[model samples]
Target: MASRLVAAAASSSSSSASPLARLISRRRLAGGADPHGPAKVNLWQDPMSPSKWKEEHFVLASLSMWGVVMYGGFKIFAGGKKENKNEAVPTQV
Candidate 1:
């Protein structure tokens, strides 16, 4: 009797999954596999390999580099601007 019950339970579970459940399971299996290329890692984890770094990390690094460059250029060119501001305005009488 116990053997029959176990077999029945197994058969029910195997065949009775809802359509949505089957679809979700199939989607997960197909979409979760990244077979097109190798997986990426964090920037800090592998600093030497930019190609292996994740897309977001590359974007962040690029933005940060540009920000630094812009800031440095601004500072280099802005040094003369401060002196102009310090000049005394002509008295309005």
Candidate 2:
């Protein structure tokens, strides 16, 4: 009677295993199921085609341009260092 119970348990265990195996074994491509448009190229690869440049490249370029603009504006508006009149010139011995 124990041997019959063991045999029934083994069969049930195997039948339950197949569905889990099927779920785990599914294959999908990288970047799966997303709607993709035309492939983007590097900014240097196609300088004129801003739309075709990679998103990261566009962001970096935009940030760099803004940094330059801000620095230039600051330099232009900020007054240069002034000399202190209180300091006396050193005399030669």
Candidate 3:
């Protein structure tokens, strides 16, 4: 029973990577561009001028960093609490 529970949990937690890989490949193909292709126009360089681009980049980077930090912290704290509840109970010999 314990082994079955562990197997079920493991299967649910670990998914096949092929679907995600295929999705990314299909998206790349639909974009009609090589993933390793040449450089495109830089957001910070143009006759139209990317003045706001720098500010946008800074804001987005800051927000992303904050999000990652907060998420990691939350997982570190919240994961332990959930871990205790979800642990598989030991079976009698």
Highest TM-score scorer: 2
Clash pairs for candidate 1: none
Query: Model 3: per-residue lDDT, tens digit, 1-93?
Result: 565456555556557744344333223246555445444444546425434345566566568889999999998988655434577899999
Candidate 2 worst ten-residue window by lDDT: 19-28
Candidate 1: worst 10 consecutive residues by lDDT? 19-28
User: How much lDDT does each candidate structure score?
Assistant: 0.76, 0.76, 0.58
- Assess candidate 2 and give its lDDT: 0.76
Residue 39's lDDT in candidate 3: 41
What is the Cα-based TM-score of model 3? 0.31
Runs of candidate 1 with Cα error greater than 4 angstroms are: 1-33, 80-93
lDDT for each residue of candidate 1 in 27-48, tens digit (9 for 90 to 100): 3366666658988899999998
| Per-residue alpha-carbon lDDT of candidate 2 for residues 4-87, written as tens digits (9 for 90 to 100) | 456555656566665444334224465676658888899999998989999999999899999999988888888556687888
Query: After best superposition, candidate 3 residue 84: deviation in angstroms?
Result: 6.4
